[model samples]
Target: MRLTRTILAFALLAAVAPIALAQSQVEITSDVFVMNEAARQAEFEGNVMVVHPNVTVWAPKVVATYGEGGTTDIRTFEASGGNVRLKTADQDATGERAVFTPGDQLLRLTGNVKVTNASGTVDASELVVNLETNVSTFTSTGGGRVTGIFTSQ
Candidate 1:
């Protein structure tokens, strides 16, 4: 009886171990640029790309906010005249200005935003994506357009 109980406990532990060890999300690449060490304020420039399980982001400049613990708290990412591309398992988006909130897992893009998926493409002046809910919202300023392309595979 004792051996059987021990085996059951071990099996339960093994099953739960993986779930506990798994991270909420993952990041692919990051580049941080610091102006002054004493200030702890920095700008991340260059091809700052991040690939999560369901989304990706590309930005040129990202302003970082640090906490007293010397760690990052928030980041305001921006890309002007450049492009910000995002992709997931089922959808994709591109835009000019991309703002990301790492702590909240939110992304907002403005200026000629385009989203494409298995169904079609949506074009708007502004776009917002919530990673936690996997939902996206598109808004337009003045004029907006949505184009759909269908190709048989």
Candidate 2:
């Protein structure tokens, strides 16, 4: 069966308005950055790393899609391959691929997703996180349940 997923752009814009307004200048570096003005898309390949105020993303490739034809108007991001890692504050997470939709204030991590912090680690096949609400949901791709291990001092 073919399933269609739809997300409203404006809704995403509204959901992420707070983050957009409070964001600081973003710095990105990679072996290659491919920008397409006409398509309003940018792709960073080969050890792509993005540094923002409180967030850092590292991946083999990262893609940004924009609504307007400018880099400042990024709507969403996809970090893929090379065990994508995302770090913010005291949290660190790794996955095969991660999709962050600022507009929706949502981050989706897939393929052996693992999240860790000072406490412990949570592992699952898929993880969805809401940046605004600070909530997360994890689902296993197979019949197995999500797992977590916490250590206390």
Candidate 3:
């Protein structure tokens, strides 16, 4: 019975270990941080930076709106200030403004958006990324055209 219990305990631990490690929390830092509980919003300004497991964001200002669950259940994140940038393990992107909707797993960047990766670089007036599907779409408005420079690697 003792040996059987030991084996079962090890199996349980192995099963739960991955889940614990996967729940990496996001961290944000900036020169100023403000929370408005009444509005269910939090704002970071002056060289705001956010670090997550998959990506990092840098901007002059970022505002996060939470659902009823508060900060843990963020609904939307908006970043603005002429030079918003995001960096991932494989790519980097910059734009004048960026908005992320967690529920839809969508990120939208507008105003002179540029994305660069090992494969190529693309420039557009707007960019939409579907985080869940790992797909990105770019578009140019006001009678402009999307441009890209790709290099074979």
Candidate 4:
């Protein structure tokens, strides 16, 4: 149970950490909002969006779990089943699925992952962003090469 809670904390924090480290209120909206208090989970379907001061996430579906019986404290979230987008003021990432865990300090993006910023764009089959160290690693193993277009320093 403690591990689950820790994972939840990591996962949800990973999603927003790229934007900033400070804690802020996050707002999520969708066509359907279903909460299961018994399970401490929520399901948002159809045009699901998680919005913050400097960051925004959009997907067709998002599954979130809360911690410590707190409805507002989302410990973890997974977005899937479409072009899942994580956008900040300058950077943008899109993938088929996105999973974040801040406690573990890992952010995973898979399936046609593309990350773009003013500097350039990177394409990979999978992307792992280390939230703790602010490092990113991209890989592709399915005969698809990791491609990137880099601009000036």
* Candidate achieving the largest TM-score: 3
Residue by residue across 39-84, what tens digits does model 3's lDDT show? 8677789998877777788999988777786455667788899999
Per-candidate RMSD vs. true structure? Answer: 12.3, 8.8, 10.6, 6.3
Model 3 lowest lDDT segment of ten: 12-21
Native-referenced Cα lDDT, model 2: 0.75
Summarize candidate 2's per-residue lDDT along 28-91 as a digit string, tens digits. Answer: 7789866555676667799888777777889999877778634546687888985899898989
Clashes of 1: 0
Order the numbered candidates by TM-score, best leading: 3, 2, 4, 1
Better of 2 and 3 by lDDT: 3
TM-scores, in order shown? 0.60, 0.81, 0.82, 0.80
Error of 3 at 74 (Å): 0.9
- lDDT, candidate 1, 2-106, per-residue tens: 675445333322221111123335343446544433554445567766544445566765444444544323233344436777676887778887766655767
lDDT (tens digit, per residue) of candidate 4 on 9-122: 445534443333456766777898665657877777999888888778999998876678464465666889868999989899999998876457677889999999999999
C-alpha RMSD in Å of predicted model 4 compared with the true structure: 6.3
**Candidate with better lDDT, 3 vs 4:** 4
